[model samples]
Target: MGRSKDVLIYIDRRNCDFFQNISDKFQVIFGLNNFWLAKFFIKTKYILFVLVNIISFYNNNENGLVNAVVAIFFATVYLVKFCQKCEIMEKMYEKGYNLFNENLILCRLNRGLFFVLLVLFCGMGSALICLNGLTFFVCTHMLLAFCIVLIICAEYFYACTPRPKGKSKVKLLFQKIQKKIEKIISPEPVPDSC
Candidate 1:
């Protein structure tokens, strides 16, 4: 009984550490310094749109691909504008200005966009749940929804938690992978001959 309790505690601790590591990596990837957040949003939305269109096509719905392309284009434009506004706000904050008063309109617009995204995600999740009877739909759609929720939760945790000291494990792993790729891609020089 004692051994089982110890094993359970170890597992719980490991899970917490894993979550913290994920949260840290999420923060670094989506840090507010540049366009990472914008890129993330754009990519995620585009992928989701594509997935939805694929599902529609499988269901014999015409015009799904065209609609997906149109939606992605508009979403990309909106996300770019939103990212610009966020950058402006960050600049204002850095300059010691009151963000709320200085960027009232932009803030409102951001809030509106956020709510729209929230509603869209919720609707998609509901649609997936409704189609849960289908094996393929349940596997793909629900997995996508789970990933989206996990990302959101990670971001939220990152915002609430203080930055951990030392380099992130994810960053180190990426750096190692990058170095290996570079070594593979850059061929060694041949000896001088003739």
Candidate 2:
């Protein structure tokens, strides 16, 4: 709710040289609580996903490669979740800069303990890899793929909430349990993350 003085701002790292020139060094007011860590974590997820896709595809790594095979689907799913219902707002600060075209998209989200869950899952993956005689640094792709699988599963559960007409029993279950799970994760009502 406050225009934070110190905050973590993130954008996906683009490999192309052109994006470096156009990247805005502006801090938009963050609409949530102290979310530097959360924002950084979300950025990390995208980095991991992209790295995994590159490494798996480039190295021809197909051993236990279901995650790689369906990566495009997962990427699409993640994009839909993040970019759904975004509204581009006309600029109020573009009076001087003619060379730089800039606009903001208002995208709302129910973060709903997503950052917390992601850390836990990623940690679990790290633990699994460590136990199997592998270093986390050595197997970033597998670890992230594992974490992303859990993220997609969580997304599925969220999607099943009884928001639509003619709700199924599963949706009803989600509706009833959603509040309880949120409460368990946080005492105060959690706000949007994205």
Top of the candidates by lDDT: 1
Per-model lDDT? 0.52, 0.41
Please state the error at residue 133 of candidate 2 in Å: 2.5
Residue-by-residue lDDT tens digits, candidate 1, 1-194: 99975775465445445645665566565443322443455456556655655675566457766765675577568656655655654555457665333333333333334434565666775777786566555455554554355444323222223242456556778899999999999989998994
Clashing pairs in 1: none
List RMSD in Å for every model shown.
11.5, 21.5
The parts of candidate 2 lying over 4 Å away from their true place are 1-47, 56-60, 63-66, 88-110, 129-132, 136-194
Q: In model 2, how large is the Cα lDDT of residue 80? A: 56
lDDT of predicted model 2:
0.41
Scored against the true structure, residue 11 in model 2 reaches a CA lDDT of 21
Per-residue accuracy of model 2 over 85-170 as CA lDDT, tens digit each: 11111121223332212211111022224444556666766677777765544476355655554443333222221111234455
- The stretch of ten residues in a row with the least summed lDDT in candidate 2 is 85-94
Model 1: weakest 10-residue lDDT segment is: 153-162
